[model samples]
Target: MSDLTGSTDINTANLPIIDYSRIEAFFFEKTAENVAENAKLLRAVNDVGFIYLKNHGITDEKMKQLFDYAKEFFSWPVSEKEKIESCESKFFHGWFSPERTSKTRIADQKEAFDIGDDSNLVRPNQWPADWPEFRTEMNYFFEKCHEIHLVLLGTFAETQGLPKDHFDSFVNEKDHFFRLLHYPATTPDSIGDRLRASPHTDYGTLTLLFNDNSGGLQIRGKDGQWLEVPPIPGYAIINIGDLLSRWFNGSLKSTEHRVVEPPPEWSKLDVEGRLPPRYALAWFGNPNRNAWIEPLSSCITAESPQRFEGVWAGKHVADRIAKLHKDGKAPEVWKDSMYREERPQQQQQQQHAQLPALA
Candidate 1:
């Protein structure tokens, strides 16, 4: 693996690369080669929390199609895309325009569409009426990512000395989210002090990120310097999230990361003097709503006592989502967001009556 470090970029670190084909082979039969690959995976996550996964099952054609779809969707006029604005959904599903979803003073210079499981009764997906293929293709990709999540989850469990199927029960209800993100091309004046994505740690267990290799993604190193994360073609960037860090009792890192403005040299300017836009897909793997998340016993020791109280996976995620909204609070009784508080009888009845058909 090549290190990102250069004389001018002395702070950058070289992140480990994991081969998913070997991980798959190890899942079936643990030969020495496969076992070594497994150990590399465990060490990478524990030390850096982010790694590039090559030979992952998703084909290049599929990824290209998804990116093409994202570009087409983002190219739509703002008014058309706003029809399914995420604010319209109780569970924060659907489209969010640029600058509308930020929690920081510097707004994120990107728009996104969030999709949850089709079978989620309260979190129904909102689709663009004009793009039927978008829905079909995205759902297909979503399922593919979920399959990878399961396999990775099994590997994590086995590496932690638990049964390979230990996390299987927790994900039975599939409380995951797949997001399509679009960062519009930028000019110096328009993007002054703004980032494509602000620094933040993800709230779920793992985040599988697919990018078009436009660069600008960076993770904060242990030494408190930002390290560039170069995108490698056909490799998905995988990172541990807060939930998994908690579950592992901080044994695994949940590194802070962000997407900075693309360097001017990376893309040519359009007629409008904007750099080329960036597109990416992020699949967040979360446990079921009721799954209890606590430090595993194996991760706890005298040197590192439990640092987190057990919390419901759904509630924890819901709370994080709420913080990004202007109100900084979610509905007290939103079942779809998985807030445990009970809703008033009349409200519950009305919402149930108007529930949309699952996508």
Candidate 2:
């Protein structure tokens, strides 16, 4: 809980690396030191946009398991990986080879798997053939990430002097997204304007990422320079996103970040031919589809009125993804889910008529 006020200075040329073990004490005891630590959490989120949190209780053994699954999955041949292509699920819960992507302006030489809530909001996931253990492991990791999100959210509420569960209602069992990514190494000479992931802001509330130490991730600092976020053992890199930024009235900025070309240093470990691949797991925590987001009353002031209009979390995220993802569509299954296009006029009218009359 010691103050690292000096560490947060933009001039420090570093992203604030926080010790999160103390953040828990703030919620239970609320001692002056714990409160100070919570303050640091707020300040770092508002200023840095990206942070490395240590001692958050995720063990090395668990991390290894997560990455091992990713390594095994990505180790498959392109044709094998394509067997569960997102098109198969229509809900975007399967693999997305480099050729199937639209997130980059140029073709990204990588592949990924996007998995999340399988409740009524989205279709069921597509399991890779023969890798039955993948589902169990990923679900465990996903739930772990959500548990962390709840802790942080509670900490956020405490910092703002709101009820501990201020954000509780906004999240449900199905309001999360996780993606496993593998970026294949291309020779430094081969990369053109295309990047592994183009510079853009994340679309949800908060992004929690576990990097396997390959180091292509960079955060755009307020100074307008790209700062490399090197791997810190036993820590995950967390960043604010657009929805959270809007809720804070732009106070907590969603720092723009991207994965650039992989460096030669990564080539030393050649598991699949000369292709040196980098892997990272991303967990996106979004609010419920109907949960409204607007700048917090505490954040608005006479000098700084509300800076954004209220928005429904789920719809906004879905819309944004549809625009950025390759093909601009989820799998055909999305049509039956909440993200499906609007109903026809006749159907809509009939549905409305079925509703009970207002008093």
Candidate 3:
């Protein structure tokens, strides 16, 4: 396999765009068929921790409509928007009102709406139901995104030197949470704690980011400095997450990244000027709840063994995120007294059970 390291200055203006035909050619090729320079693909993944894609099967017209719709949804007055507050969901995991959240711990001057791939769990998002096009467009986007996700999985498998079908079994029933985020105008005072997203690795195997041209995405480099990801049009940025990072035996880094509000450019007329709100859709992919996540046998040998014990994709992700929120580490999910109250009793029982009685 080629190196995963990538260039430092990759931005929307300079990044490569991989359209649908390109993606199909690269991912659907038989093992016997030689593909384009595999090295270049690996270099994009390694150096930049991500890549912008174009000619990806998704159409520009669809994207434009989606963006316009999102802008409209986020623009609703606070009272009307709060009708379906995210907190109403059992998990604090749905449509969040504006300024209702920050990075897991630090405040983020942004707002978002979250959706999952599970048709059962994904309600017809609380659209302004009166608009007939609302449901139609949202569902269309979901289906299209779902299709793209499968294609990308095949690509990831090929990149790892595995068969294009390698990820198929584990992902038969996946949990892909799509979040549409809007970062509003920010003042200098809005910057807090050097964290736009807190330093945390995504808990899934991969992430697909559909970003706007106004870029603030940053990823940590091998040298421990953060590098900004320039938003390349026609290309959505894709990145490796924790599971993929572990699967590669550290070959790829699940680097840390945070978003920051952009400083004013000379074009802005006022000192308290703000940049246009940035919108990005992040699709996080995971295997079915019962799927076992052990190192792929092909990726390990007697010398390396296994780096992580097998884990259930669902519980594993939920627990890690829960712990972080409780410790004031990450702020994606809010905690309830029930979660905190039951903890001590469970710990005390475990402690007592482990103690040896005097003989």
Q: After superposition, how far is residue 312 of candidate 3 from its true place, in Å?
A: 1.3
Tens digits of per-residue lDDT, candidate 1, 1-359, equal 65342334334458888888899899788899999999999999989999989898889998999999899988989888878888634577888864555454555778889988877776789999977888999999888888888888889998777888899898877789899999888875666677677778888788999988677788988888888777778889999988888899988888888887555445567898877788999999988766678999988899999887776676677666755564322222223234334346534643444222111
Report the C-alpha displacement of residue 259, candidate 1, in angstroms. Answer: 0.6
| lDDT values for all models | 0.78, 0.71, 0.59
For model 2, the superposed segments whose C-alpha errors exceed 4 Å read 1-13, 87-89, 101-105, 118-122, 262-275, 327-359
Q: What lDDT tens digits, residue by residue, belong to model 3 across residues 25-104?
A: 76546333325534445666666556665566667788788788888888888787667665423343556733453234
User: For all the candidates, what are their Cα RMSDs to the real structure?
Assistant: 5.4, 6.3, 7.3
The C-alpha TM-scores of every prediction are 0.86, 0.83, 0.76
Supply the TM-score for candidate 3.
Answer: 0.76
Clashing pairs for model 2 are 90-331, 90-332, 102-326
* Better by lDDT, candidate 2 or 1: 1
Tally clashing residue pairs in candidate 3: 21
On lDDT, the leading prediction is 1
Could you give me the TM-score of model 1 versus the true structure? 0.86
